[model samples]
Structure formats: C-alpha cells, structure tokens
Target: MSFADQADRTLEILALTPGWHRLRDLRPDCDDETVAAIVLEAANFAEGVLAPLNPVGDRLGARVVEGRVKTPQGFADAFRQYAEAGWLGMDVPEKFGGQAVPLTLHAACAPLFERGCVALMMAAGSTRAAAHLLAEVADQDTANEWVPKLATGEWAATICISEPEAGSDVGRLRTRAEQRDGEWVVTGQKIWISFGDHDMTSRIGHCLLARTNDQPGTRGISLFLVPNEIDGRSNGVSVDRIEEKMGLHGSPTCAMRFDGARGILLGKEGRGLPHLFTMIELMRLLTGCQGLGLASAAADVAEDYARERRQGGRPDQPPVPISSHPDVARQLHELRSTTEILRAAILELATTMDIARLEPQSGLDDFTGWMLPLIKNFGAETGFNVAGAAIQVLGGVGYTRDWPLEQYLRDARIMTIYEGTTGMQALDFLTRRLWRDEGRGLAIFLQKARDEIDAYATEHPGASEAALAALDEFERLSAGMISMRDDDPDGALYRADAYMRAAWSVVSVWMALRLSETNAVAGLAAQFAFHSARCA
Candidate 1:
C-alpha cells in the first residue's frame, strides 16, 4: 500500500479532528484544508521520493571521501526537494523562513517522511531541532544569522554530546573550550554524532557541549553553536570517520575532531546542559515520532503480506490467507493496535506541547517533561517489537533483505539507545522527574489520565471501565513504588524498569480508551487492559 493510503487511515484511526481543532485554535492561519494539504503533500513525497530510495540507500550507505561524508544515491536531490517545498520550516516562525504551522501538524506529518526513509529524515530532524533551539535560546544576532538558513534547509545541524568515555554521563565529557580573542575555540572529540558530517548541504550546525572551567562534573559545561565553515574555509572541524553501524546506513554517524573551531556561545555560561537540554528534549519528541512512523509502516506492510500469503488452515480445507490463521491474526491485531495506541499517545503529547508553548504558566511544562521519557522509551520499544512481529508474520522472507522488516528492526534498535537509553529514561523518570518531585508529577499524570477516562466513560462503559481498572492498578503500583523509594531505596532503583514499563502500559491503555471514543474498535481497550493487567 502507498504511504498516502496508510497515513490517511492512520489519521482516521487517530481521530485527529479534535486535535486539529485544538491546533486551529492555536494557529488560526492553518485551517483544516491547509493542514490536510500539507499532510497529503508530505505523504506523496514520502511515497514517491523517499520510499523508492530506501533500499538503494541501505545498500550503498554513506561513505567518507576526502574530509566529507557522501550520502547515498538520490539523497541530495530528495533533500533539496524537501527543502524547496518548505517542509523544513513547517512549524518554524515566519520570520525565519518558516510557515509557522501548529506543531501538532508537524508531528502528524513527520511519520510519513520517517516511514519512507528514516535516515534521510534524520538530517531534516536535526535541522528542525537546531532551528527551534536557535529560535528559543540563542542570542538574537546568532539566531538571525543561522535560523534562516536552517529553517529554509540551506544547511543541516546535529547535537554533539557523546564522547569515547562519556555517553550518558555528560558530566564526565573531556571536550574543552576557551576564549580566543573575541571568539570561543572548541577543541575536542565527539562520538556518535548523527548527521555530523554530510554532503547534502554546504554548512552543518553543531549544538556542542563542552567544559569551560575547572568546575567538576556538568557544572562548568557550556553550549556553543559551531559551524563547519568559517570565511569560506574549514572551521577546524574534521570528519575523523563515520561509524559502520547496524542500521540507519544512509545517515552519517560521525566521529568528529575539533581543533580550535570557532563558535558562538549559546544561552548562558556554565549552564550548557540545561540549554542543550532544550534541543535534546525536542530531539526526543521527534525520536518518538520516528518510532511511531516506523511501526506504522511495518504494520502496513505486514498486514498486506498476511492478507496475500496463503498458509495452513483447517486440515481438510484448502489453504487460506495467512491472516485467517488465529496466531497470525493475533500478531496483526497486536501490531496494528499497539501502533495506533502509540500514535494516539504521541499526538496527545504533541497537543500538550502546543499547550505548553502557548501557555507556559499552565503547568503543562511539568506534564510535558514527565511524559517525554514515556513517549521516547515506549514508542521506541514498541517500534522494535512491532517490526519483529511483522517479521514473524512474514515468516522466513522477513528475515532477509528482500523485505524491509529486517531493516526496520535494525533501524529501531538504536532509538532506545540514542537520545538516551531505555535505562537512562527509566532512571530520569525515577530519579529526576519522579523522585525529584516526590510523586507530584506522577499524581498529576494519573489525575489527567483518570479525567480522560471519566470523560470517555460517559458513552462507552466497557472500554472506559477496562481503562479505569488499569488506571487503578497503576495507581496502586505507583504508590507502592513511591513508598519503596524511602523504604527500600536500593530496591526501588532495582525495580525502576518494571515500574516504568507498567506505568507506560497503563498510560497506553488510557490513550487507547480515549481513542476508542472516536475509533470505537471493539476490543482495543480490552487488549490494552489485558496487557496492562499482566504488567501490574
């Protein structure tokens, strides 16, 4: 099936009207027709441009020549088309060469591109995040200088955080920066930098974090906006080499060496982690959309395959489509239903992000913050599982390169690792978001979920009750975990992963319940209830 067919069905299943209405309220300039047009155009581009190149890109990947990385076949042309079409500026400000649409629309449109070619989408993803970062935190002059180019997709950007020794432990990073005359000179090495070096554009922006003083840990860290060029020459930044990775072959993941690279400091001094976190959080949100897109695409292909492939049925009967088999049906159901649930959750999160942007004092920031890890971690893990299940539905062929399922699984493996590992997300949920606030965030989240269930229950008792039961059980587990924080601190840490998963299951069911109000799938909530009960 084509991406347009698939995305249309997904938009319907998600029942995006209410969210659309909310978005319209937020951005009066973007009406339903305009939004629909944007989504359709994106879907068409994904299907027509990116999908055909996926296999070719995977086969060729990106290669380093001289000091630059060359992206796979058709990548540069496709990227240029994506830019000229103004997609890179979908949610950006008009002053920065953007269309200034609702972020919800961007979230809705992203999966189409991601599903078509995730590696290609990564460059756009980094650029969009960089544009947002500059608009939000950069000095006015810096923002004016770079935002227009990035927003217009004239260049690309990347987040540089990891090092050989420091992965999640950003506080231990050894990258250093010092003032030289009036400019800062950054000298260090960064590893696992996605889109770090690519030939798709003339300039690449780096949102870099490095040490500036003798202060220990993350305290002395600072953020800088470093470019790949200065005065028509290399800016002391070299692409040491690109990593031979398991997936995302088309996207260049580079190991970079910075020797006296000139940079403009972003935000405040000695507060780089916090400033860089703004971009990190944006990337995390986009990463969740990436997972959702991949899962949706995998489900589409697997369902199509199952409907066509003939397989065993009753003993005396002729073979029926594999989709008719009970186990195969279950896999399809799980894959589609879970993908829909994740979509709803992601959209819900996007809506809240819009709200947070429009009304900062509404306490939605806390909500968005607490929900980030859930969206990022759960969405990623679901993508991997759904892709694997798709493979199972395809049988042996799914394991081979003949099908995209294998590639989907490989691409998904890194989502849970990069943008913060699953373990790190759980730790942040427990240590930073949950334990730091001492359960207030969780309480707020539970109340919001209950409110949604109650609102949904007025019409559908069965699904609502199922969701409520899951919510109650989640509440019980949460209370127990909170008590364990003080009662058995070490034990609580040990159980963090289980608790996080259980909480996400409950959250997914709540989203499913809300979705049922519009989609009205008979057993959707029941399935979620059963799974969540097991987790509880």
Candidate 2:
C-alpha cells in the first residue's frame, strides 16, 4: 500500500480503538474529518516536496565546509517549507506555538513524512521530540525560551547520550558540566549525534548529559541544554567531523566537542537519564514509524513490480504477470499483512500513549511501556526484512540503484541499532517491563487481547481461534520466563529474544484480528494467521 493508503487505514483503525471518542473529545480540532484533511495535506507535502529529495539526499549526502555541516542540496529548503507548514509541531502544545493535535494524528502522518525522506526527517523528529521534552522537564523559563523556537523549527536539536566510552552503558559517560560564576559550562565530546550539525536551522541545541558531581555511574549525570550559538555568536560548540555513514546520508551524524559551552540545567541535577527518557521514549516510538514507512513503501514497490513484471508461465502459453504465480502471490499477501498489522499495532500504542497522558490513573502507561520495546525492535526488523523481500520480488533490478528498495534497506539498518539495539529492547522487555513491573502490563495486554477475541469470536471464529491459541502460548512463555527471573536471571536473559519473538507473534495475531474487522484488509487476516503461526 502507498503512504496515503496507510494514512487512511490508520484513520480506520484509530476510530476502531477503544476510547478514541474520548481522545477526540479532548482535541476537538482533531475530529475525524479534520484529521483526515491534515493527513491528506501531509501526504501531499511529503510526496510532492519530500519524496523527490530522498534519492538526492542519499546520493549527494551531507558535507562539511569550513567547520559547518551543509546538508544535501534542497534539504535546508525542504525543511524550511516543512516548518512553515507547521508539520514540526503537530503534537506539541499550542502554548508552545504548536497545533497540539492528538499524537494519534501525528502517528498517522509521520509514516508518510518518513516515507518521503527519512534522512531529512531525522532532524525533524529530534527537534519535535526535544521540544516536548523541554515542555515536560525543563524549567518554565528554559522551556519558554526553547520550546517555541523548536516548535516553529527556528532551531533544531539533538539528544546527546552516546559517547566514545558510553553507548548503551550510559553510566560510564565522561562528559562534564561545571558551575562557574552562577553559570553552567559543559565540556565533552559526544559521538553518534544525529543532526549533530546541520544547516537546516540557524541554531542547534544539544540536550546533553554530563557528569556534574562525584556520584558514580548514572547518578552523577545531569541534563543540560547547550546551544551551538549564544547571542548570535558561537557558544564554543564545534563539529569535529561528520561520520561517513552507510545510509541516511542527508542527516549529518557528528562527533561534537563542547569546550565549556554555556549550559542550562534541566530537571533535577541527578535525574538526567530518567528525564532524558522523556525524549528517548518518543524517539523510540518514531523509530517504529520510520520502519513502518519504509516497509510500506517497499510493499508498494514490490506489489507494483509483481503486477507489471512477467516471467515464467506454461510453455504452451504466453508469460503472465509475476503476481499470478503462487509464490509471488503468497509473498505479496504476507508483505501486505505484515505492513498493515504493524500499522495497526503502532497506532494502538500511540493511542494508548495518548490515553496514558490524558488519564494517568487509567493504567495504560504500563501497557504502553510493555509494548514499546516490542514495536521498536520488530518495527525496525519489518522494514529491513520487507525491503529485502521486495528486492527479491523485483529480481536483479531491485538490487540496482535505479530502484529505491536498496536505499530503503540500507537506511533501515540503523533503526534496530540506534534507538536501542534489538538485544537491548529484548532485555528491557524481559527485565524491566515484565519482571520489575510485576507483569501488570502483560496482564493488561492479555486481558485486552482476550476481550477482542471474545468480542469477535462469533463472527470470525477462525481468526479468534488462532489469536487465542497464540495468546495462550505467549502467556505460558511469559510465565516461564518470569519464573526464571529469581532462580536464573541469566537464563531468562538468554531467552529474552525468544520471548520477544513470541510477544510479537501474539501481538500480530491480535492486530490481525483487529484488521479482520475492517472490510478493506479483512482478506489479509488469514495471511497474518499463517505468518504468526510460523513465527511463533
């Protein structure tokens, strides 16, 4: 399906979600018609303005000239148009110069933008996420100063966590912030900083974590907002160099050096990691959107190619479209099924997160937390796998630069690695989400799935049966892993990947059942059943 089709399906799924009315009531301007229009406009902009830049950005990439990073040609202009269109602040609060629409709407629109040009969208995501982070954690004055700038895209931002010594082990970071003359100064070298240096915006801010005291590990780290320019002058922030990455060449991932750059502390001094999670969570969710965008695009390409490209047929007859072949047909069904189900799942999570924000006591937060890691990891995997599968369907032509599948494959490779590796997500799911949370989220998910199955069982017995069985298997596996938590934590960690796979299978079944209720995608429900069964 195309990105526009995905957006329309997202609206269908959103209306089907429980409590969607309540969410709609909260954001009156985000009613179904309004959101549909917004998404349609976004789709048009993404296709007309951003899609053309995808290949250009990949080919030209970003370059550094005289210490400043220059994004690929048209990137800066495209971002300007994007900002002017108010795309950056769709979900940000109106108080901070945003439209403050429901995140579900943003989620629906995001994949389209990502599909258009993920490389440029990297800068957009961080800026928007950082604006929300500041609105939540920074001091009123600090938020007032930065949030609007970010919301309007007058400036861009980066979440600086990884360093030479600290990648996933954030505790070992050596960046330091010192208080001097009633001002904070940060001194550090941060690597793997996306949009670390870009000409898309005049000012760039770093949501940096730096050691501030003698406390050990993460305890000593504090969050700081360090700008690249202060009072129209350089603030001692310099780009040492931009990495020559395998993909996403339009986004300049930089190795940055801060030589005592003036900084403002955000949130509590010792709660940097916890505070940063605000931004990290949103980015992780967006990573899933990124994956979905690429996967959808790949599916569209493969399906189109299969219908047009003809090859083998009976010797006595003329060649038929490859899509007529059983193998190609099956692959197309699986691809479409996986893509649509993942879209539903991501929208569900996004809606759940919206509900969690609206009603803190609703217990949806735990459920959202439970599903975040799964979506992040599997979402990334789906994009890469789908692109590879699409390449196969297109034969040798898909592997060549003439097609976008290869670029999509290369670009998607980082999603699994960056937000948190698949291993990291699995470990987090098993240890923190399942074990530490006491399976509250798991309980919520299981009950929810069972409710859906029971609701649809009479009409869709086949889908319900498959879903229930998968849910039962998932529950049993989860219990087994949880039981091992005390006696064999290491063993549980070892089984984390398996447990996560099972969770994805179960979730896929649930999503397939959800999609089965919709007329447009009902045919793919059986495909999901087969896919889930095989994966499980």
Q: How much does each candidate deviate from the true structure in C-alpha RMSD?
A: 1.9, 1.8
Regions more than 4 Å wrong, model 1: 13-20, 314-317, 517-522
Which ranges in model 2 have alpha carbons more than 4 Å from their true place? 517-536
User: Per-model C-alpha lDDT, please?
Assistant: 0.85, 0.89
For residues 48-81, what per-residue lDDT tens digits would candidate 2 score against the true structure? Answer: 9999999999999998899999989999999999
Pick by lDDT: which candidate is best? 2
- Model 2: lDDT to the true structure: 0.89
Cα lDDT of model 1 overall? 0.85
TM-score of 2: 0.97
Index of the highest-TM-score prediction: 2
Model 2 per-residue lDDT at 40: 85
